[model samples]
Target: PLAAREASRVGAHRDAAGHYEVALRYSDALPMEGQAALHEGHAFECHLIGRIDAAMEAQGEARRLWQALGDRLKEGDSLRCLSRFAYLVGDRAAADRFGVQAVELLETAPDSAELAMAYSNLSQLAMLAERLDETLSLGAKAVGLAERLNRPDILCHALNNVGAAGQWLDFAKGRRDLARSLGIALAGNFQEHAARAFTNCACVEMNRLNLNEAEAFLDRGIAYCVENDLATWRDYMRGVQAQLLLRRGLWNEAATIAHDVVDDEATTALVRYPSLVALARLRIRRGDPSAGPVLDEMKRFLDKGMELQRLAPYAAVMAELAWLGQGDRAEALRLIDLAESRSPTRAVVGELATWRQFLSPDSDPGEIDGMAEPHRLLLAGDWRGAAAFWARIDAPFERALALLQGDEAAQREALDIFEGLGARPVAQHVRGLMRQSGVSHIARGPRQATRTNLAGLTQRQMEVLQLIERGFSNKKIAAHLTISPKTVDHHVSAVLEKLEAVSRGEATAAARASGLL
Candidate 1:
């Protein structure tokens, strides 16, 4: 079993599986205590291979074996791992119950480090279940336990939860907590863990509209990641860097980097959504509604999963959905709330939540008090207001949004802007796309088919068609145009006939494509 586990650790998958099988067969002849250890090892290997169901089975068997051997601590650890597997498989209620049992059994265990695992798992479970209040309470408990344990690895895990708890607090509170976590992580001497901590700090800064601080923290983290050869960190840092570029108005660079990042194999689906959404927004800003389809793609991804993947990117998708006139503007807000509740002390979700609240109809966006506000203002379609607001930020993401939203002729000019900002990857990406076969610089999609123009439509008919395109309910349109809902229906039929569109969304897309909007 030990050989199998070590082989698995060394990445010899086939060899490890064979060795695990051999261990299982040999364990059939051993005492229950020996068998439990063997089965526990087998289950651990199964987990490492992503055979989650098999892992559960092995874990169950191991728990029985451990119980027979009277090894309560091993049984508790096995239960905790199994509970996490169940949670991952959509059995949260079961996970919750098992988690409580795991902790109860661990209560008198003298090893603080072992006990910290149970605490961390419980905290994670609370966060995943969207119990924000529970998340904070559990997070606090986990951090205290990890501190008492005084183990670096355990401390790293606890700091993550602390950051998450702070994430739910308002700006100053979130910042103070993440900074303290940062100091602890740096003191722990795990470069990768410290890098992650720095990234979280950047998120808090981003949320507070402190772009300068965010940029500095993100840059430092990325540099650390590069130095450490951490694949996961590199991918994450790139995503954060891409967003900051867009914030800074480094349009071409942000878009270009976003384009590249989306295709990186190391990028998770969580990373994929944000990169694409950012790219899609850039396309929209570039005066291309083709982003409509891209935004739809992101919305679909947002609906798929939760867990570590459910936080930052999901909120970005929800915000885009609302912006694009998907029904239930509140769905976006609801998702933001969910992400905030479920994620541990992380920067992206909290910061994005802050930004979303700032941009919300119910709040004063200016409370964020950053140069990013100009773009927030520009979201209502005021280019000049945003352009003047651009100088206050030096972020790449804002520039990418600017280039995307800028006039087509101005895109070339924006390329120089990206180069000036030292974002060569982005500039190189855009320059590489200077020409493409069968691609339109300006997208002209099914535009009511110039062949089927609305020439014969009367004034009243045009009003109805516009309302329909705007997603107005028939009753609502009737009130707007001072006509009966039935009368509005007749106008919609006539407009669809003239435009040859099958649905109001199609008609609206056509109308916008034809410059009617």
Candidate 2:
């Protein structure tokens, strides 16, 4: 037990689990309480190492032992562990049942850390289930109790749940709470809590479209997880990273990371969720035939829980795929209805609304307050505005989508961008639209190598290179492109890097040499 504790203290989770297993082998010599403690310790280590089955079995044993010994507090602690394990394994019903039982059992005990944790557990479950009001109430109780007890870990746990959920209603207040939780975890050297804090912080930034901030948090979180041997959190953070890359228009890198995480057999559903979303969205855009199977696999996650985060993304993906003139539009509409009814956060509503726009192009979505910027622009039928925003953020795919909402000239430009990105699925759809609209003399898209661009320059970057070749300054390019100089600067830097050049002159030379001019 001492060895296990020491190993866990140093972040050697696998070693801790092994030590706990050895201790448990001889635990029969100990009293009931000692045996239960061993089981609980082993379960925690197993949980950290992503051994859900072993964690559940050990926690169950601990729960039974505590129940037999008439220790309600210990039993409740075990139940909370079981609840967490169940949730990680995508058994939402079982998780909810275990959490409720845990809270009920702990309520009968005196004020303690265990009871606070029970409240936090239920709070987390409520948040994931999108019961925001219940989430806040339970989280408040947990936070209050944890504060009074001076339990930093419990406080961090409660704040994380409440803060993330609170963002749906109030972004600033939620961010403050999340920041506070992260501060506490860092100060206390709570490695697991810190990893979670980093993950949640990244998630919040990503939700608000603060791509730079999100990337910073992801970098720190992934590094911390690697240092601490937190494979599960590492994988979850990696999945989120893939999503961020997808949003940033780094599709090939995003697809690679997503596929790596999703294809790994040991990944839990929780870790797989975001990566699967990235993969499905990417494949759908590229018109990959395997997209259907990927989307179907994502759908199976809903059988575990109908959380807004899950439902909204799934609905948006399905809606877009359906709008591409495939799949069942009716089913996609049904999902949109369900997501809007559950938790209509502006981000969710905006995403669903943007996709829903295509399903019924004539139906104006009107104006929505606090809608995300790109969605707001799209909803207002300002394709240029939307495209400019995506360009500033370096999201070429979304910019292309935005351009598709414009006239023949804009649509032709959109087709060029899609072809440049190797988005054949959407490119074909655009070609069909052009044929219908009687736009003649369409240029054949870039060859396979050109579409995949040997220099790895995006369409926007290619345009920036052409302007550079004309000896246009960043300021001039920004004015010509209707974007900010800062954005132009960013594109210039990316172009220079991709061409492996030290100056604009060298970049132009490299572009000419590679026939990208």
Candidate 3:
């Protein structure tokens, strides 16, 4: 039954629910103990897919059915599931009370896995309630209990929760703990566990400036959630990924990702809209010229966020946009000063400080400490670090912007770096700029994409994408490749449509995502 329920998580949600409904029917037809067990599984599947009201209904029926049958263990399981549901919906106080009763009722039961579920729920509740001190005090005990019983899911949750709660830990110590948690999560085959660990690792690595690794890990995490059909977290990770891209300087791509994420059905925008503001800030930063609509959209978003939830992050964004677009130095100062009045966590305080320094360059360091390791790598003239950071963030424009700023020899070097990483569009743009700068063949190193794994590309299509990536317009490409400009136009549309791109910037990103460039 666990295996079947877990299977439904992979594809066709309604199909999965149908299977559970059938399972529930059979359980009702079976003996007392069988009926008790079946309802537990049914309620679990209900909760997994966000049918919270249905879940609570099923669980209530399970409790009544189990109590009537004199099934103490099944009754306890239903109560624990209720506690999980309550905790999920932000009822930490009731969750803790129900959870303790669950453990007490199950003391003589042999279901170690079920027992671990309750513990995991308790651990998560503690984390969400900001009982970090209590979490640390109780976390090791939970780990010991889970390990002694050999419950992998409980162990995974504990390890990940420890890392989440450890955000307040000292930097060096936090990194070591998060890295260890990531290793354990990767070792586990559970998709949810892997997603949790990878996302946690992305956060730590972002703080440490390991941009390349952060991007890679986040991709793995987001992909895992998508594949696992974890819709709620899939939406949450979308916000995280967009923020990384915006920070890396891929404004349009960031906006596109933000566009999909902000509409995800399962999440509220308390965390999500701040991400939109970041993208809006980027549109403003790149001097997009046609950003008037987006700015108004952002202001409306901020206003809505303020009404829905009083989040400090949204307020920080008001400052960010002021700094990015209006150049209202005094206004920016006033906004940040106002932000300090709210409870400034690391994200608010750190980003508020960093964005200001990034723009002014001459602004006082204030207490930012330093850029994330990835940002530092890009800033410190490390080609490999810059490549890795930009790739993780998938920020092709930023990578190109830096390449454009480089001297001739440096441009060639940057070109080689992008080319090597399959950044075809960016490398093409660089080559076009180099030609305009009048330094085409005067440089060294291989810009040739060298026939590697063409993967899914047709020979003619590959030729066209390569040319377009190299910054050749339809006329130049048609002239060089002996095709009509009309044919070149036709081929470009084919490539963009096939790549699922909505714009040129998006096309470059799609190439990167597909490993085509």
Candidate 1 residues 312-404, lDDT tens each? 564665565454443256776777777656654443343454445533746533322232355455544454455555545654444443554
lDDT of 2: 0.85
Best candidate per TM-score, number? 2
The total of clashing pairs for model 1 equals: 24
What does candidate 3's lDDT look like per residue over 41-105, in tens digits? Answer: 66766665556566677787788889898777777878888887655444446567888888788
As for lDDT, the candidate ahead, 2 or 3, is: 2
Ranking by TM-score: 2, 3, 1
Residue 201 of model 1 has an lDDT of: 79
What are the lDDT figures for the candidates, one per model?
0.61, 0.85, 0.60
Alpha-carbon RMSD to native, per candidate: 14.5, 9.9, 10.9
TM-score of each: 0.53, 0.85, 0.57
Candidate 2, 283-354: lDDT as tens digits: 788665657777887899898788888889999899878877877899998998888888745555787888
Q: Which candidate model has the greater TM-score, 1 or 3?
A: 3
Candidate 1's C-alpha runs over 4 A off are 1-70, 78-101, 108-111, 124-132, 167-173, 189-192, 226-229, 251-276, 283-390, 395-517
Clashes of each: 24, 0, 7
